[model samples]
Target chain A: MSAKIMGFDAYNFNFFWLMLLTAIEVGVVAQSENMAWATLIFVLVSIGVVKFIGIAAVFMHLRFSPDSNVLTATALFPVIFIVLLVLMVGLTSPSAVENLPAFCRPGYYGL
Target chain B: MSDDHGYHHGPHEWSHGAPHNSWAPIIISIGSGVFLFFFAKAFTMNEGMNGYIYDSAPLPLAIAGLAIIFAGLISWWKQDFSFDGSYEPQATHGSTPFSNVDIRKVGMWVFLMSEMMIFSSLFATYIRYRTSIDSCYSLEGTVVEPGTACWLPASYFIAKGGEHAHSTLGFMPDALVPGAINTFALIISSYTIVMALKTAKRTDLEHAERSIKVRNYLGATFCLATLFLVMKMIEWFIGFHIGPFEAPSLLSDQFTIHNDAYTYNYGHGAEAGAMTVDIRMAASIFYLTTGTHGVHVFAGIVGLGYMVVKAHKGGYGPGNSVSIEYFGLYWHFVDLAWVAVFPAFYLY
Candidate 1:
């Protein structure tokens, strides 16, 4: 059962999808500006997903090991990193102090 | 305790780490750090002063560092050395806890993961800068003559030019077409590497020969990559010579190399460097990002060169193709980065 499961072939997986996305991104960037924006975001998200799968599936050899704990650790690490980065950038990127309109400039605000 | 049950030994264990008196790796590390630090400092410092001394240090340090690394590799490769009194291989504390396949593959993957981030940060920057400028340009009307009645504020000029400004309206014609061709070359190389891995997995000598054939194809791919690097360098030199910033093309008048302030088009009879703002931010960033990636490609080529040397010595096969696979992953990642970079930097 383990042998069978280990060698089981799924339909096109992450690497395949990644290459496809690359081509699609090239096409989108070339033709449509709107599509280009979507493609850019999509590619970044796709890269994160594909890297997660590669690190977990191949590097950890979970297909052979069947360790549930290993799977959890591998997936959790990336999620935590991403979430932390997002939280950091979200809070800091929009600076109320710097971004205020001219009328509300610091001197006039009497702070 | 039963003889075997109380303490089971494994092939992966080795007992050499703490007792060993090897000073090579530490020395090499320090030497490399010093060399890179000096090299970077040289770039930031004035070219006239202390340049001679700083430039001289790196080459000798690099050679000595390589010598130490080579000595370590040779020592590691030797079969006679062992922690146990017996010459025969033993299960001890320092033995690598990985099959060669696993260790090398993991190493490669780890390497590629870092590389992916490097490329990602660059692409992300390009996207942010491009979107900001695009929105600004559309919001404000067509860029017009500065200091005229209709001229925008110095702050406005400074903000546009101060932020991510572009050095050129579009990429020079030569750079883009060559870049596209190289993209195709990289894709083809990825295909060839897959074939090499497939051939290595076969159980026959003919398959081994086929593996060599595939490796040769891989080498060809490297050659193509090298050619692409050469073409890119040539393109950069030509751009420098032509001065992309000083002149203007049909699309927009606001681009230059040193700074990206709004400049009047040369065709529109504006003087060289005439502008309320310098708008070369986009182009400079574009060059720096792509140029750094190009350096990575060059490093990958060196790795491939080493792999080719080992391949000739019969060091790789189905059991040992992890290095090849990892490098292939890196090569493709780079190509994919360029795929985004070319369009984002050039087309938009």
Candidate 2:
């Protein structure tokens, strides 16, 4: 029972695939022009999140570690604070939220 | 008879052995704290009416503090490696919640948590400023018409004279090739580090064979990391026009333009000089974020260099590879931070 996902041989495999995917993502973002600014930003951020998770889970061995719960908690707990801070700034600060892209605005997106 | 009498007592008793004591780490922490305080103070101090800067005199204090801190750190490292007073593993704290985990690993994780907060604050600052400036730019059309437009994307700002500028939101060159290549180099280095650790952890290989393998892998990792830095420096040089190159200094020439906006092509006329693209907030955020990440990469290189020396000396193996693992954690974090930063600062 190896703790690694898909066994030991797959570690390099996973890394290679992830790297290729990240390069492709960058290329797509750079070349694509038809995308809405908001949509492009959203896609870029989403890809970044996925790449981060891949590195953490595979390279850092978070998935295979005995104390995975503790590690995951330590890594993720600050995200709550980040989300809260963004929310507070977006809602309260007039100047901060005003020029946000159309997707972030309330009425523009039908929110 | 005396030895037997001492052996009767538990290991916790002082008689078991002399307790560990070293002043270097404490001195280093104090020095670092002092250095940080004065360094910050030097920046925030006010310039007086007669041109004498107030509170700026602390810069010397900051430098002295940094010197003391580095001295303490070097002394500590030497003491650890010294034959006369080398480090000995201490008994584990039995009461720890993570009884099964190595205490050093736990310590590394805690340290990483603090690092996360530091980066979080930097990211927050960037987001706050970027959104606010964008908002200001958006309001330009509606509010009292300003003499010039408020915001221009980084591409337009960098393109000489904004000649290629199509709309208020024009496509700017993001230096995509350099960024992509650097990303690849870092990813490869990450793989090599894992290979080094794996080689060190293998039990079946002869000690000499494992040592060679570990050193080779570490050497490869170091070269790749250095390659990444070299690429980064080249990118900055070309972008900023720091050398004799004909390209404009993006920071000084374009970002500083204040009240007026116009368009020209550096490509069209050789004597047109540099195109100005003044969006101070965007320029500031870009430099700060990328600059901070570059500092981290430099630090990681130093750590890897140390590891390479130790590997050559046969310092790590299955039973004593914690140091390598800790370094790996730090290196991985640096890579992870760049993952977020590349798209935010470059691609987007």
Candidate No. with top lDDT: 2
Every candidate's DockQ is 0.12, 0.47
Q: State the iRMSD of every prediction, in order shown.
A: 7.6, 3.3
Model 1 residue B347 CA deviation (Å) reads: 4.6
User: lDDT score, residue B190, model 2?
Assistant: 80
lDDT of 2 by residue, B73-179 (tens): 66655543322111223324453455445545666778877777767767777677666554332433243333323445444433222332222213323334456
> What are the per-residue Cα lDDT tens digits for candidate 2 across A1-111?
024555545457667777887766765665556667777777788877887887788777677767677677767777787777667643444676655666766787576
Off by over 4 Å in 2: A1-4, A7-10, A89-92, A105-111, B1-29, B34-59, B79-97, B135-174, B238-249, B256-278
TM-score for all models, in order of appearance: 0.57, 0.76
Task: State the RMSD for candidate 2.
Answer: 6.7
Q: Evaluate candidate 1 and give its CAPRI docking class based on DockQ.
A: incorrect
